[model samples]
Target: MVGDALASSPGGYLLVLAVLVPVIGMLAMPVMGLLRVRHAASLAFATIAVGVAVVGAVGWRVVGSGEALVYGIGGWSPPLGLALRADGLSAVMMAMAALVIALVALYARPQFAAAETAPGGRRAFGFWALLMGLWSALNLAFVGEDLFNLFVALELLTFAAVPLVCLDGTAATLEAALRYLVFALVGSVLYLLGVAVLYARYGTLDIGLLHELAYPDFATHAAIALMIGGLMAKAALFPLHLWLPPAHAGAPAPASAVLSALVVKAPFFIIVRLWFDVLPGASHEAAARALAMLGAAAILVCSVVALRQARLKLMIAYSTVAQVGYLFLMFQLTIEPGVPAWATIGWTGGMLQLVSHALAKAAMFLAAGLIAEALGHDRIDELAGAGRAVPVSLFAFGLAGLSLMGLPPSGGFIAKLLLLSAATLSGAWWIAVVISVGGLLAAAYVTRVLKRAMAPPPEGIVTSPVARSRELAALALALCAVALGLVPLQPFDLLAIGRAGVALP
Candidate 1:
């Protein structure tokens, strides 16, 4: 069994292997070029399978022991050597990312098959390699203990994601890619500056060490502000979201799925780690309120924008911005001391929102792709009768939309409920109001598309059909989002298991 292997293992090398497996596959792509097409497919598939196994093994070890799995690099502990740590949250994220990437690879095969046989046709191959690279980088970002190591991982994620924005080499896409690049570069500079300040003050870059060393001094507070501000820009929170709609809507559907559903979350995850783990008891009430305000604006303003969108993809992109706003609301709700047990509910709710959004958004984007393929366009008004032509894709889109709208028995519904309860307990009345209004706006946009799709076409408009397997892939993810609601409504001890002993609060 995997547990036996982990038990017998000497160090955190397995965690390292989990991150490296995909990177190694990416590196071997050129070497595998001379082989048959089937050989390349087999190599990539086997690598992904092994990655999933490694993540599962790590997760089993973490949840079974109720302690984090720690591996110190080069036989040296933290402060002198790098450390890799896997807690329940990190393990779950790694597993989810692996599953999504593997499925995307399978789905992209049919779409990108034509490029595989052409001379110098490395674009599709590059896309696959970069997808694996991004996966590995994300896992490393989740688990790496050193700030510098995380910086490297974040850079890798950025490099991998930027190219995906302009994969088709169109002028508009290239402009969007450039905008994303510039904005993300600004974020990187600010983040690095914060790291430098922290290192100077604490004399170490290890998160655990810094957490123990941190004090509520001017330098620390300033560093925290700078770091969080940087992450917010990258995460596209509120006013900083100028780059998201264009970039996400312009990218290829599979790429958009990964970019919106996964990439933006990476930076936000880091911000969470910084606040909860590094700052501990430090209270930046004013700053936290500022973030919450931005989140409220995003929810109100972007939801309206989504409602006004003429294109299905742009509408989804706007909805993503609004949903991201809800995530930041957890910071405001959970940070208060006298709040009820429901405050913890907000914590779990925020995470559920993250996971459910990832699955649901990916499914929605893939369904949109299939619809565009069938109808030859994605204009919402012109989409009449699309549901009849591609019922499975429309069904998948509707199911995912149900989650986005926070409807019954869907993960999004549970997440929003938890957040609303927490806001009520914390006396954050505005947040509660925003959550309700946001759900209503989501319902409006979703119903608008469904109505058009279900109606008969005006004239003799006929659309092509999509492949069954592709539609099924999207439906599967949508179903997963809905299934997450089955999880109990407790504080989710698994999320809290290894967090208690950490150096942060």
Candidate 2:
């Protein structure tokens, strides 16, 4: 059945192309020269459009057929050669990444445009090329099957991302970028060490092969713990988050949006793959509980810290950390035996939370960027009456905030609802309580910003106009998050379509 699906599926080749196409463009950028950089943006948009179409087509296949699409590399099957697989979750992530990339590219043109006279400058070329590189690396990370291969993709992602943080070369931003690079490198070292142990024990790096072999030895458990812990540090989960706020808040607006919305997610996704796919039944429940506890700490501590931030960008950065905590709640909610088959709701809910947070946070960061660009700063206290100056940006911020707060008719609401239901069914009352408190904290932070935005300008306050197009782009992404709420409340069979062949605990 898997072979038949592979033979018929177009997504396999498309998956490879999705990762390579942007990289090819990145390599071609220097040759194109500065006068042609604008065309590079157009090329990027076109490539992303093609990628999204392919992913959408694959999503249709998954939903229609209720199965995954898999392609054996070199026709050599797993354990000997690498394979690429896409289920509903991978499809959604690919599409979401494409959409966010396209939007950021569009929004960047005005902000990143170089003067015709100075077209060949460093900023313009560097930004465009690095953007493409970042896109390629991210797609590769999503579809990669081998642990070592994924480490390469992760390194690519980090390299592409770090320079973006320090693009301006300002002292403060450079410092933040250095901090990020060091911490992420530490994470990579730990992750690579874990992969080495796994390969030593199992003789294969492919996830499918590892799943089939089911390494239940002490080496396997230790490797899984190390890999997951490394990923958590890279993902900025709580204590390891020392590098996040500064790096994210200090970057340029477009850079900040991408870093916050998509970059951190790659590591978190890897951790999910580790625990759920590779390790499966071997996962230590105690360890999972410890991870969830840290997530809960992140929620309570970071949400309060976000509320206390004086700057809009920093508040959003801290909010990203808090939102990340919610994704871990699934560990506790989805692990119980005798749980209804419908309990996959928690898994789907976690994914929806990831997708919606990406879209909404991207929009919020971009809106904050526009505000900062107009007023020359993002001071929350000074934002009074700023909404009148940039109503569209303000509206975009509010709409995105609605999703973050888990309000009705938004993806965040549905995600929280599913998670809460799972918690109730499993009798994990604390998960439900934490989720509820997180929502309220979200509401508090969002409302604080909205209230200040809508109020009359304080005496002596001043504001300037922001670009309408950028504001609209942000609003569009926020609207997508709102639209995700329309998906029906169910087990979300699509996510499970490809899992039957893979051994699950």
Candidate 3:
């Protein structure tokens, strides 16, 4: 079923269109120079909405027909041509990206409006172009079956995202963008080196082929190590997270949403593919534990740092680093020797972590953005009357924080619960302890922000009112994160639909 789910199909033309539509819009912006930002944005939104529907249709077919949708470019199979494939995980990720990007587009309508004095303004046009490019790259990353294809997707994603980081063109933002570029370039080099190593040894870069060819050899291990290390840096998985807070906090709100919610997850998804799908046996228990240890450190350290943050946006950014750490624990917990990878609770938990975090973090960032707009700042300590001023935004923030804190009826709670169960069952007591401690630390930071936000303010606090529709947009995204907790606690068969014949040990 793993191969079948990813097998090429005529219906897979939808995936091609899904990725290409956004790229087409981005390229056509210059031609549409006469179109105002609003008109151009409308066209981009309409086109991308259709692209999203195509992706949804593919996912619907994948789920209903119990097979992944695949398109081999030019009707040629691997070893001769490239391919796009969507399994359970890929479908879920693409769908998530589409939904988040759409809602954010709605939220950004007012934020990116060009001043009439500057027709075809740089900031507005650049933001939309970068957004479309980012969306295209992400869709390709999810569906790309070849390692080289994924590499290109990652590069496109980086190029699109790096500019958004420095959109303001301030000296500080420029430095952040340059730093992000340097780290990302280093990661790209390491990842490319691994791809080269694999191609030299096996003569093909297709993940499905690599699954059959990879072995417990020194070169194979070396390649995976390099690739995973590179992905960790890109994922901002602690220690290498120096560039994350500044870049994420500095970018405009919409950019921050996509960067924090979607951009980083692309590399982490590749890491998952490399470990479980491509080189399962090559990744041993000891190596998994090493990654999990680093994750634990991130959860411990970053959560505390978030708690100490003075600015609301900086706190949220640091929280993202800590949230990323939890996903790595799936590496440790999914090591049951006799069980298939997708059948495990840890596997489901990890994927849940990915989807829920995307929704919740996007909501959190947007809420912070609204707060900053209203108050002209996001100082956490001065947020005494901000909540009363913008109740809806604060409410959205609290809901998103529930997921981050792993509170009841939130997706983060469900994900962490499943992971905790898996750790206890596996007798990984240390991991269980780490999960509990991480949750507490998460709670501390969230409560810290809420405590200040809810406090009574001194006299003479100016409160600017935010648009109700924008508030609804943020709230809706937060509700999606919370809604994921309603699903039953069991192995998600949807995620397992593609792994039936994989050579898991």
Candidate achieving the largest TM-score:
3
Candidate 1 per-residue lDDT, tens place, 180-236, comes to 988888987888999999999988988888878888888988887898888898999
Estimate TM-scores for all models.
0.94, 0.93, 0.96
Error of 1 at 331 (Å): 0.6
The candidates, ranked best first by TM-score, are 3, 1, 2
Clash counts for the predictions, in order: 0, 0, 1
Taking the tens digit of each residue's C-alpha lDDT, what string does model 3 give over 299-383?
9999889989999889999999999999999999998877887889999999999999999999999999998888888989888
TM-score, candidate number 1: 0.94
Which residue pairs come into collision in candidate 1? none
Which is the leading candidate under lDDT? 3
Which lDDT value does model 1 have at 117? 67
lDDT of 1: 0.83
Candidate 3 segments exceeding 4 Å error: 1-7, 34-38, 115-120, 280-283, 501-505
C-alpha lDDT (0 to 100) for residue 311 of candidate 2: 99
Q: What is the RMSD of candidate 1?
A: 3.3
lDDT against the true structure, each candidate: 0.83, 0.82, 0.88
